[model samples]
Target: MMALQHRYPLALAIAASLLSGPVLAQSAIEHHVWQDKRKFEPYSRTAESITGAIRLSGNNQFATPGSKMTITFGNGKKAQLTSVGASWRQWDDVDGKKVTAEVFKVAKDPGTLLNGNTLCGKAAKYLVFHESLSFGASLLGVAVFEGSKEPKDINSPGLCGTFNYSVD
Candidate 1:
């Protein structure tokens, strides 16, 4: 009985090591690769556009995940989108001679303040936005997502840098 007790631990440890060896080896061989554009869907451009960015950590480096923004301009007259925030803010400038203006919440993502997948629950945890804009009958805008926007009811995101995507 004494000999069996000593051998049992050693035998179990050996079995465990053998069972886990392939899994551990496979994990060591797996790594992430970077690409300028996703082959599944090369960034696209149209009269409408979408854009934004968020950090995606892989290996030792962090990269911006992918996001697409579409725009509608020229004949486009109105803009509207849903917001994750409880309210939306809009600013109106009455020229350099303005004295005062209206201040209120629109209750949604008015004028495209982080809408669509940025707030949707069914999308990736990170958002990386890319925009392609043109002048004639084309769209132009920037999109950015901050992990801070994530629900506080859950544990806060631990990323150390601000996530952003801008268009110029």
Candidate 2:
């Protein structure tokens, strides 16, 4: 189970296969869910939102400058969040030298926006840091996808989950 925690970020990568399997494309993949998490009542929702990414090709690092993040609620329901930014670094296997790879992600909730397109609209800003690592499971390496964050800007979005080498 300890390895699962490290794989939290990659949750989104398998989300497609877990939901229906390898038959649809990215555009067709609008919603990613957990096989067991969705079994609960509090997780099922017709009006839900999610955002994340996985390594696809080569080693790279990504991020959004500043310690600020936001979620678009509706036309006027928006929220901002800050998490002191998250960072991770470690060594893997490199021909026997214990080579190391690193990744730094920073996300925050920027409050809520009121009058939006619908009664429930939300969005958040994220940065992906895939230094010397592939992200997309079927494509990249490191995969990190957590719940983002909520109004607290610290408690993590609604789901409070993340992914990395484990899930990847």
Candidate 3:
């Protein structure tokens, strides 16, 4: 009778674990994929307006006098002017080497434009830079994307470095 009493307690414990196994497993899986929708509300603005200036400068130490840069926006917007006139010299650190860098600047026509019909009734401001040499060599440039409601300062090297713009 004593042995039977001990065996009865063990049997009850096993049954309890078996009954709760599926419930615990289902709760764990549900918790992993759950997301709170209240944190992801969308913006209410539909169009964004941008105004800025673009400038491109190349190093004269490399003797790349014909180095060219261009800026394009949305689909059809592009720099208005293609004049390379400004030149300066400064000490610059390039790839861990310090040297006197002769720089020449290419100015782009400054203007303003609008990008519209964005989804979520909202849009972001961004700038992209492109550089190419007369020898058929191309260097990839940088892009910046910012999501904001106010005017932003858009600047980049080997491209535009000064500008004022707004989004609405």
lDDT at residue 128 of model 3 (Cα atoms): 28
lDDT of 1 by residue, 40-67 (tens): 1212331123323312122221122122
Candidate 1 Cα errors over 4 Å, as ranges: 1-18, 26-48, 51-143, 146-168
- In lDDT terms, how accurate is model 2? 0.28
Tens-place lDDT per residue, model 2, 43-129, is 112222222221222211222224343323223233333333333333221222222222223334333322222212333233222
Poorest lDDT segment (10 consecutive residues) of candidate 1: 86-95
Candidate 3 lDDT (Cα, whole model)?
A: 0.30
Instruction: Choose 1 or 2, whichever is better by lDDT.
Output: 2
TM-score list, all predictions: 0.20, 0.20, 0.21
Task: Give the TM-score comparing model 2 with the true structure, all chains together.
Answer: 0.20
Off by over 4 Å in 3: 1-63, 80-108, 115-168
Screening candidate 3 with a backbone cut-off below 3 angstroms (N, C-alpha, C), the clashing residue pairs are 45-121, 55-159, 55-160
**Rank list by lDDT:** 3, 2, 1
What lDDT is reached at residue 28 by model 1?
A: 66
Q: Best-fitting candidate, measured by TM-score?
A: 3
lDDT for 138 in candidate 2 is 18
